[model samples]
Each structure stands twice: as structure tokens, then as C-alpha cells.
Target: MDHHEGLRETYAGEWQGLTNSEIRARYPEEYEAWSRGEPVRRGGGELATEVADRAVPVVLDAVDKLPDNGTVVVVSHGGTIRTMIGRLLDMEPAQWERFGGLSNCCWSVMGQGARGWRLLEHNAGTLPQPVIGDET
Candidate 1:
């Protein structure tokens, strides 16, 4: 298993370890901007793009080391994984929020296709069902 520190979640500066209510009470404006997907430095921490920049490379590097049919399992925090997916999909920072956050212990899957990378699943915990139109 490859572990990269760059895959760590966005640092929530002063908001670290605080509940949503606590952060909402303390940093209302910043929290609102965050909710709207506008870039705000949480507690003077990293931006979503910054997190993506650091994380995506690590993921790509791991992918490069895999055989064509091999699978790699990356254990990462939700925000970091989301950011990485946005980057991998060539999405603008604002569009990152379109991909909903993952529930605890849930995971996403991506596969390289003929066109490019595609998100096979999001926030999933079970084997994927066959697509309705697929024949195998």
C-alpha cells in the first residue's frame, strides 16, 4: 500500500475538531462561503485546488505503477478524495461540489476508459450492479 501525506484532508485551521454548529457560530461567513463552494481558506488552511494539486500527482504516480488490469486501493479522506476526483476529471474548482461528499467508510471508483477517466461509482460500499444495457 502506498501512503502519501499529500492525500491528507484539507486542513481546517481554527475549525479543526469543531462541530458544524461550533464553526457556524464562530465563522459564519466563511462557513457560508464554504457551503456555496466558493473558495475560502478554512482557518487559513489550504484551498480545494491546493489540495487537488498536491494529491492528484500522488494518485497518478500510483496509477502509473499499476499493470493495465491491476487495481489500486487508495484510502483517503473524503474532501481530499473529492478534490482529487475533480482534478482527475478536469473540473473547475466550483464544480467540485457537484460531486457530493462521501459517507464515512464509503468509497468511489474510477476507471480509465477509451475516452478518458470515468467515475464508475461514488460513495459506494457494495459491488456494482451490471448496467441495464450491457451484455456479458
Candidate 2:
């Protein structure tokens, strides 16, 4: 398994390690902007786009290494995974929030196609089953 610093979870700066209520109580305006999806950097932390900028390249690098019919699993936090998925699917960073947060141990799958990337699954906990017509 490869460990890449670029794939690390976003650094929330002043809001780091704080609980939900704590973040809401401490930085209401900033939190509100983020809640409205206005691209505010939470506590002067990285923007969601910035997170994708760093993370997508690392994931792409891994994808480039896979042999034919090989799969690469990316294990990361919810925010990181969400941003990466949005970027991978060519969605705007503002729309990335549409992806719901993942519970622990859940994973999403991305499939490459002639057109581009497709989200085969999201927030799944079980192993992948073969698709009836997807066989090569």
C-alpha cells in the first residue's frame, strides 16, 4: 500500500480537532458561509477545491499504475473522498457537497470508460459484485 501525504485529510487550521457544536459555536459566520456552499475556507483552512487539487493528482497517479483490469482502492476520510469523487466525475467543486458524507469503513468506486470516469458506487460497505454486462 502506498502512503501519500498529498492524499491526507484537509487541514482545518483553527477549527482542527473541534467537535461539531464547538465549530458552530466558535466560528458561526465562517461556518455559515460554508454551509451555504459559498467556498469559505473554514477557519482559514483549505477550500474544498484546494483539497481536490491536492488529492485528485495523487489518485490519478495511482490509477495510472494499475494494470489492465486491475482495481485501486482509496481509503480516505469523508471530505477527502467526496472532493475526489466530484473532481473525478468532472463536477464543479461547489457541487461536491451533493455527495453525502460516508460512514466509517464505507467506500466508493470509480470506473473508467471511453467517455471518462463513472461513479460505480458510493458509500458502500460490502465488497463489489460483478456487473452482468460490464464484463470485458
lDDT of every model, 2 decimals: 0.88, 0.89
User: Candidate 1's residue-wise lDDT over 2-95, tens digit each?
Assistant: 5799999899899999998999999999999998889999878899999999999898888999986888788999999999888888889999
Lowest lDDT block of 10, candidate 2: 127-136
Model 2, residue 15: C-alpha shift (Å): 0.7
Residue range with the least summed lDDT across 10 consecutive positions in model 1: 127-136
Clashes of each: 0, 0
Report the number of the highest-TM-score candidate. 2
